[model samples]
Target: MKTWSSIILAGGMSRRMGSSKALLEINVQTMVELLVEVLTPFSRKIIIVSNEKDYEYISSLFQQALHVQIVTDDPLYQGEGPLAGIYTGMKELQDSWYFVCACDMVKLHPNYLVGLQERLHTEIVTKRQQYDAFIPYSEGRVQPLAGLYSQQKETIKKLLDQNKHRITEWLTHMNYYRIEPSEWQGWTPISDVFFNMNKPEDYLQICRERGK
Candidate 1:
């Protein structure tokens, strides 16, 4: 079976953090940079979608990956959220599945991703399934932002046709599978690794955790 591709969703408004969340630094590296590093081994390609103004700095981060496209949304589709980025990335990628991730998850543990990897391998080995989506649920809730999508070209067109702009809303319309967090062992703090930067205090706390 062919390996799937990935796209990192980096266009959040980051209102509470009061700046671009994609640019937030943790351990001397930008959040998006860290995310790209993690996904580098797994992705066939990496794409970034945000306002052109917001991406100029980020575009320079990967000097070697000229193959990784950094795209700006068409003004007509401004502020439509992560779904817009997902649509844009899926349109350009040839892979049947795309692993999409949010940039703000700095505390993310590698084990969570390993769990998803195991699922992919299982699907390939057992069912030989052709799923349209794969999302993980930790403690009964789905993390739509951190999930794998078998982003079929036809389904993407349907989503665009419906004018769906929310990730959660569209996930409801797809044929997908969700795994309980416990299904995977060695999973770390559900909250710590998923700590979303909300305010100045959150950044301070994360800095302290990093021993800064």
Candidate 2:
């Protein structure tokens, strides 16, 4: 098993949701909590990168789980976007690769992540291989929310120190991997594994899909 910590990036403003999407409910459980449940099977430790008062509510729910920790970005880094959240999470972990994820990706399959963990053995992988990050692309777009990153304190700090805020811009500076849809054949049961819950309408679609 790959010894890694999973970091859920819940610090985004969620302008589209008009509220903290991380706190959204699906079958009475908050999205973040549900993500934690699925990640427990794969990670040694879990951290939440969040903002706003809602974290208190979320924290109360996970207080018993010793492996879960929550960290909010400093004022300077806060509101800077997902890159800042990713940087904050990587710095928090001492000696493990980070499976960085976003709270919005509600349909993320655990097997999909397991597949990526198995891919960790490739020669293309490295702790300091100059490949600063890894991401998966699907349907013609790079899915930044689902990624695996090394716990490089310097790289994380440099990211926070830089002017680039958008993840795509920063991705251009790093060497990374793009797992095509064709690569996941017998692993995950779900296709479009990166399908995220961006809007309420999408949630309704998931509800419909699940119903069928």
Residue pairs of candidate 2 with colliding backbone atoms: none
Instruction: Quote each prediction's TM-score.
Output: 0.87, 0.88
Kindly list the per-residue Cα lDDT of model 2 for residues 1-212, writing each as its tens digit.
64578989898777776778888777777889889988888788898988866668878888899999988875678788888887777777665577888897778888887877776655345543544556777788878778787666566557668776777767766677776677753558876777767777877786677562
Over 4 Å off in model 2, which ranges? 122-132
Q: What is the lDDT of residue 120 in candidate 2?
A: 66
Error of 1 at 185 (Å): 4.7
Off by over 4 Å in 1: 74-76, 185-191
Residue pairs in clash, model 1: none
Worst 10 residues of 1 by lDDT: 184-193
Give the TM-score (vs. native) of candidate 1: 0.87
Please, what is the whole-model Cα lDDT of each candidate in the order they appear?
0.73, 0.76
Question: Model 1: per-residue lDDT, tens digit, 1-212?
Answer: 22567777787778888888888888889888888877776777888776666787888887678557787754545567777778777777767778887777776676667667778888878987666777767655787777788765566556666787766778777878876655644555445455567787888888898886
